[model samples]
Target: MPFPIKVCAVCSEEFELKPDKPGFANRCPECSIPESTGDSSTKQRMDADERKNASEANAARRQAMRELLYRKDS
Candidate 1:
């Protein structure tokens, strides 16, 4: 019995289902030409959102660390 797999819509790369693999991505995780697939703006927005989330999280962590160090000195 062959485990069913399909070509990625983003990069047309074939992939098989492997539950053991990390993330278990069914498609190519790195598709450089997002614009050619007719979703450049969406991809860009997604990228921006991810960057913003990461930046916000990092800022929060830094603030927490600053507070902790300040309290230790008090």
Candidate 2:
């Protein structure tokens, strides 16, 4: 295997090359990526919730408007 003679910036580990992971060793072979948190489930859930809440709010507003338009101001 071709390896570069480099050292990790974060862990300070020795490797064949400086990893593309910013500060990790290229030889670490995982968890070397600085931005790779791996999972985004919470973010996805929050996004879904935001969309759902907006949709619900819109629906509620439309319903209120419809009620007002037909409501005989009693």
Candidate 3:
């Protein structure tokens, strides 16, 4: 089956919407390519650290909520 035709959100060009297309469904492949920013490894590591910190914070928030909901009356 032929891929569906989609208009690019950025350049306003028509492109084939394939299953392996990167970035967003609304954006064309050319527009989907991410601009390089120095070392990718370092950036990935920083992103991982940020995700870890965010996950920890979320866990703490859930724990606080659980405590508040399950705490016994004094």
Best by lDDT: 3
The regions of model 1 sitting more than 4 angstroms off are 1-46, 72-74
| Residue 8, candidate 2: alpha-carbon lDDT | 54
Which candidate has the top score in TM-score?
Answer: 3
Q: Arrange candidates by TM-score, descending.
A: 3, 2, 1
Ranking of predictions according to lDDT: 3, 1, 2
Cα lDDT of all candidates, in order? 0.66, 0.66, 0.90
**Model 2: which residue pairs collide?**
4-16
lDDT of 2: 0.66
lDDT of predicted model 3: 0.90
Q: Cα RMSD (Å) between model 3 and the true structure?
A: 5.8
**What local lDDT score does residue 46 receive in model 1, on the 0 to 100 scale?**
49
What lDDT is reached at residue 18 by model 3? Answer: 94
- Looking at model 1, the pairs that clash are none
Kindly list the per-residue Cα lDDT of model 1 for residues 36-67, writing each as its tens digit. 56545555454888989999999999999999
Q: What is candidate 2's CA lDDT for residue 26? A: 43
